[model samples]
Target chain A: MKYLDEYRDPELARRLLSRIEEIAPGDRVIRLMEICGTHTVAIFRSGLRHLLPSTIRLISGPGCPVCVTANEDIDRAIWLAKQPGVIVTTFGDLVRVPGSTSSLNVERSNGADVRIVYATIDALQIARATPDRQVVFVGIGFETTAPTVAAAVKQAAAEGLVNFSVLPVHKLLPPAMGALLEEGNLQLNGFLCPGHVSTVIGASAYEDVVNRYGISCVVAGFEPLDLLHGIYLLVECVVKGTPQVLNQYRRAVSRDGNAAARRLMDEVFEPADSTWRGLGPIPLSGLRFRNSWRRFDAGERFSMPVIQVREDPACRCGDVLRGLMEPPQCTLFRKVCNPQNPKGPCMVSGEGTCGAYYRYHTESL
Target chain B: MKQRTVQLDQGSGGRATHELVKGLFVEAFRNEFLLEMNDSALVQLNGGRIAMSTDSYVVDPVIFPGGNIGSLAVHGTVNDLAMRGARPLYLTAGFILEEGLSLETLEQVVRAMGEAARESGVLIVAGDTKVVPRGKADKLFINTAGVGVVPPGIHVAGQNARPGDAVLINGTIGDHGMAVLCKREGLAFENEIRSDSAPLHDLVRQMLEVCPRIHVLRDPTRGGVATTLNEIAQQSSVGIRLLEEALPIGEDVAGACELLGLDPLYVANEGKLLACVPADEAEELLQVMRRHPLGAKSRRIGEVTVEEPGRVFLKTRIGGHRLVDMLRGEQLPRIC
Candidate 1:
């Protein structure tokens, strides 16, 4: 709690809140988007939104990897789970996410040998232990998680674990940000970049967004103080009409990010056009195994049948992820969808915008 | 499509489990005793009031850091009886063993159970054992049922909680949960986390002596402090507001929860108990609880409120507040 407790000090938070209120312009409404699922949850968990000035509107973007993952990819993963002698391993976040037809949780209950692992290394270890069975790891996340998966893949290749393979659905943060700006309908004043992802890709990663869209970007940590400070920085940028990339989480994020992690990612994967659940297909927004490591790719290793993907028409998860609609605005928000019986990934994943809103903002609604 | 079957989430002691219980078990077994829905059922037997409770232990890796499944089974049942201000007296245990389990492991488990029962001043009055094929059951499973005598003038139930009642918890949360998780997953940290799997009968006894007017006494076990508090809130039709800074959590457990993307409030605790007492008597009860070995780290976590009836809120470390909803399913780790 050494590093964390200090950041959560009420005294410090009050000072920062006061400072933000003083600088925030009262003439017009200022809209800011937090493009990270973790940030969205953190904001809600701390009830920070209620404390912020009403004029500054914070919107949740498609930062949750689980929420943005396309139904086709989930269907593909479900197909792999059903394969004979295959053990499908995935992060816990993806197990409850519904695919086109079924979910991993349902498959598991039907005895499909599905396992939830905390890290990719655990999947590798499972593959190493069970030589007779094939282990398909469903790799999902942004840059913050891709390095660890890449490291595991490299370790698997070095150990020559032929039974181990990955369903690479890893996404890049900056490309999605670019896509969001290109769509040009969010009408955002500033952006609160993810801290962990920024640690891997750095504050410099958002320079392109700021340069291209002339939007203010502030790299932020997940703590209350970090978020408030990040908001104050963005507010300053908005007041001065100067769009720039700033780093408020200097302790964790650097300008250039972690070079070693980037090197590892480049060695194992290359940017490929991938489909996002809400944003549709974006060029170079996802990572795929390089030719050298292609053998470890589950998509290449297994003979997968073509999957017909479908989305629930009633679930406005696409609009929710795009920051076009709030969770309660969806017709199925708490009526047809909830944490107990989620109709979309936004309600399934903990960090999903809808899930966070439902968990923290239910009373207000 | 496959026929609907029981998934692991149904046993997670969260929303799914609640639904399954209400939709099936409670509907079929509708009775006044079952309707009360306290941890243990209070029954009048032989012109005397007694607490009756039953629990089953199927924890994976039967042997864990602080205790084994055998000890856990004993503690679980004994604590349930103690929750009703009952002096746990007798217990019954049933064991389902897998065919290839070593006799040494079985003996160790049984011995641990015996020791725990003895420590809690309870006798293993009756028991049975059965064995299944290697894959039919896990290494071992234990089911325990217990009965205890409730003293006169002692009235404690979840529904007894009222507005202006103070909520207090003994020691830290998330120890047992994190310990089991780390041991099972082979996750190592700088400091090893050991499970807080101990009987709370002695502590509860001490607490009642100081304030027999204790409103509610329930162990924050499976779905943890959060879920247990939610149950109390709904049962009593009052709101509970927890102080984020007041909730005591072990450093190692906190670190592990942070690493695993788990909330300590929702994590399980084997030996912890939540007591709701009249606001004025709270400090006296806390003083008594702190004298007991198990309650040395006790703190006043929250207070029952009239606002937002049947809801629980947390006053965050910052000057913000958020609703602490019941666990939806199992607490799943987040993707970074």
Candidate 2:
């Protein structure tokens, strides 16, 4: 707790809070979007909203990879899970997300071989152990995780693990930000960029967003002080009319990011047009297997009939992801949709906007 | 549609576990004792009050850093009875061993259990064992039931908590949980986390000696301090406010929880207990608890309040407040 406790100093946090209050413009409503799922959870967990001034509103973005993953992708993963002798392994967040007709959790309960793994290497180890059966790792995350998966794929190829494959649903963060800006649905003064993702992709990645939309982007860590300081920097930018990409989490992130990780990702994958759950068909936002690593692609290795996917029309997860509406505004927020029995991805994923709200903000309700 | 079968979440000791207990088990065996729903059941026997509790240990790795399933079995049941302000006297253990289990391993586990029972001043009066096929059961599983004598004129229950009462914890939280998780997942940190799995009957006895009017004594095991506090709040029809800065947590445990994207409040602890006592006697009780080794690091973490009945809130370090709700399903690691 050496490094962590220092950031959570009560005296320091008090000073930062007062500073933010003093500079925040009181005449107009300022909307700041935190573009990382982890930040959303941290903000709620720290009760920062209650402490912040009334004029500044924090909106959740489409940074939760599980929430942004389209239903068709989940259907395809469930279809792969149902195939005989195929073992499906994925992160725990994706297991509870609902698909068109079924979810991985329900499928697992009904006798499907779905396992929750913390990392892709665990899935690879399973494949090496059970060589007779197929082990398909459902890879889903942002740049913070894609490089690790890419390393796992390279390791599998080197070891010639024929049973190992990956259903790569990995997404890029910067392009998704562009797509959100293009939609022009919500007016956002600035953006709180993801910290871990910035460590891999760097602070320079948001330069395009700033150049295009004139929105300030502050890369921040997940600690309470980091978030408060990040918001202060964004508020400062808004007050000064300076739209620049700032790095408040410089302790972990760098300007150019991790070069070796970017190289590994470039070697294993290529950017492709992919469909997001709410923001559909963002160009070059999804990662696919490069020509050399095509054999590890589960989509190419397995042949299955296309399954039609459907979404509950009543679930307003789309608007929640786009920052167009708050989670409590949704009709099904705490009614039929809840953590125990989630009606949408936003309610299922722990980092989802609605899920975070239900966990932290329900006291007021 | 496929038929619903028992899933892992039902055994997670969270909301799902509560549902299964209330919707099925408790409903089938409805009675005054079951209705109480405290950690242990208090029954009258020969004009004396007795506390009885039972628990099963199915930990994946039969052995862990601080204790094994055998010792854990004893401590778990003994602590359950202690929560009722009873002096644990006798225990019964049942084991289901896998066919492939080695004789040496079984002896080691049994020896540990004997030592733990002796240390806690309890007797393993009865035990039974059976073997199953390798695929049918894990390496080992243990079920322990205990009966203890409740001292006369001592009444402590969850619902007895009153507003303006002070809440105290015995020691650090999340040690047992993170220890088992790190061992099971092979997550090696710079320093290894050891489980705080120990019997708390002695501490409970000393506490009751001084503060006989102690309102509530409950172990924060599965679903952790947050969930246990929520249950107490609902039962007592009061609000509990925890100070984020005052809650004791080990550095190693905090680091592990941060890495896994888990809250320490919701993590499990075996040797930790939450006590609610009158505000006036809290300082004296704290001094007595600190004299015991098990409660050396004990601190007053929160206080009972009249507002927001059936709710538990944590006052953040930055002058903000958030509700600490009960644990839902299992705390899964984040995708980041």
Candidate 3:
């Protein structure tokens, strides 16, 4: 708890809060978006949202993997889980996410072999253990998790894991971020970049974003003080009309990021146009297996009949993901779409905007 | 298209557990003897008040750092009876053994159970055993039933917590759960985390002697302190506000939880108890609790509130507040 406890120090937090207050826009409304599911969770978990001045509004972006995962991919994963002699593995968050027809959890209860794994390597291990069954790992998340999945694919290829394959739904942060700025739906002052993702892609990854959009971008740690300090840096930048990518989480993040991780990711995967649930299709935002690694790609390895993907008619998860609409503004938020029976991806994951709002927001919906 | 079936969350002893208990079990087993649901059944036998409780242990890797399933079984039942303000007197153990289990392991488990019972001054009055086919059962499973005598003028229940009452914990949170998880999953750390599993009847006895007016006594077992507090909140129809800085959590346990993306508040604890007492008597109760070995690290964590009835909140390390809802499902190690 050495490194963690210091970041959570209440004294430092108060100091940072006061600093942020000084730089905050007094009479004008400022909107800052945190483009990471982790940041959304940390903000809510520490009740940091409540401490901020009312002039600054924080919005959750399309950062949650489960939230942004396209419906077709989810439906495909469910289909794979149902196929005979196939074992579907995914993170716990994705298990509860509703697909076009059924969730992985529902399939599991009806006797599908769907396992929840903490790491991509666990799926590889299961493949190694079971030679007769095809093990499909549902790869999700941003740069922070992409490298690990890439490493697993490389390991599987090296080990000649015939039973192992990955259904790659991995996404990049920069492209979606560019899309968000171009949409002009939500007027944003700055951004708090994801800490763990920044550690992989590096703080410099956002430099292009800053240069193009002329917005304050600060990479922040997930702790409350780290976030508050990051907000202070952003507010200071906005007040001074200076847009620069600053790394507030100096301990873990760097300019170049983990170079070896990038190399590994580059070797196993390639950027391709893929669909997002709310954002639709964004060019070069999705990751796919390299041609050499296609044998280990679940999408290529399986030749199954296509199922027509259907989106919920009333769910406004698209606008919510873009920070254009609050979760409560959506008619299905707490009425039809809830954590127990999520009609949309935003209500599925705990870090999703709707789920966080449903949980931490004390006011009645 | 149809209603979802009962899942594992229903068995986690949180809100879902309450649902399963009230929505199904209580309705099916509707009787005066089973309605109290105060850890143990408070019944009158031959004009004397007695408490009875039973629990089964299916912890994976039946053996752990501090103790094994054997000791846990004994400690769990004894503590349950004690929670009802009873002096634990006797216990009965039943064992289901997998055919392939080694006698050496079984001997070790039985020895630990015997030692725990002896230390707690609870006699194992009767026992039963059965051997199952290899695949039908785990290596070993233990079920223990206990009976204790309740003294006059002692009535403790979860529904007894009141607004303005103090909430105190026995010791550090999540130790037993972490110990078992580490051992089961083969996780290693610089400092080895051990289970805090122990008989708490003696500690409860010491507390009752000093303050018999204790409102609620609950072992924050399966769903940890958050779920336990939420249950107390709902049952008592009061609010509880916990101070994050005041909660006693072990350094190693906190580190492990951080690494695993788990919240210590939601992690399970086997030997810890939450005591709700009058605000004025809280200071005196702490002194008595601190003297007991199991309660040496005891501290006041929170106070019952009337602001938000049937809710729990944590005054976070920062000057912010968040709701501590009931455990919904298996607390999956989060990525965020």
Clashing pairs in 1: none
Q: How many clashes in each structure?
A: 0, 0, 0
Q: lDDT per residue, candidate 2, B206-320, as tens digits?
A: 9999999999999988888999999899889999999999999999999999888788998888899999999999999999999999999999999999999998998898778
Decide which is better by lDDT, 2 or 3.
2
| lDDT of the candidates, in the order given | 0.91, 0.91, 0.88
lDDT of 1 by residue, B95-158 (tens): 9999999999999999999999999999999999999999999889899999999999999999
Let me know the DockQ for model 3: 0.50
Q: All candidates' TM-scores?
A: 0.93, 0.95, 0.95
TM-score result, candidate 2:
0.95
Report iRMS (Å) of candidate 1. 2.3
Indicate the worst ten consecutive residues by lDDT in candidate 3 chain A. Answer: A356-365
lDDT string for model 3 (A1-365, tens) is: 77888889999999888888888878898889999988998998898888888888899999998899998999999999989999999998898888788888888989999999989999999999999999999999888889999999889878888899999999998999998899887789999999989889999999999999999899999988899899999999989999999999999999999999999999999999989888899999999988888888888789857889988778898888999898888887778777767788888887898888776666521
Cα error, candidate 1, residue B227 (Å): 0.8
Cα lDDT of model 3 by residue, B185-232, tens digit: 889988899998988999998899999999999998887899989888
Quote model 3's TM-score.
0.95
Taking the tens digit of each residue's C-alpha lDDT, what string does model 2 give over A1-365? 78988888888989999999999988998899999888999998788898899999999999999999999999999999999999999999898898888999889887899999989999999999999999999999999889999999999989999999999998999999989988887888999999989999999999999999999999999888999999999999999999999999999999999999999999999999998998888999999999999999999899767878788899999889999989999999899899988888999888999999888886462
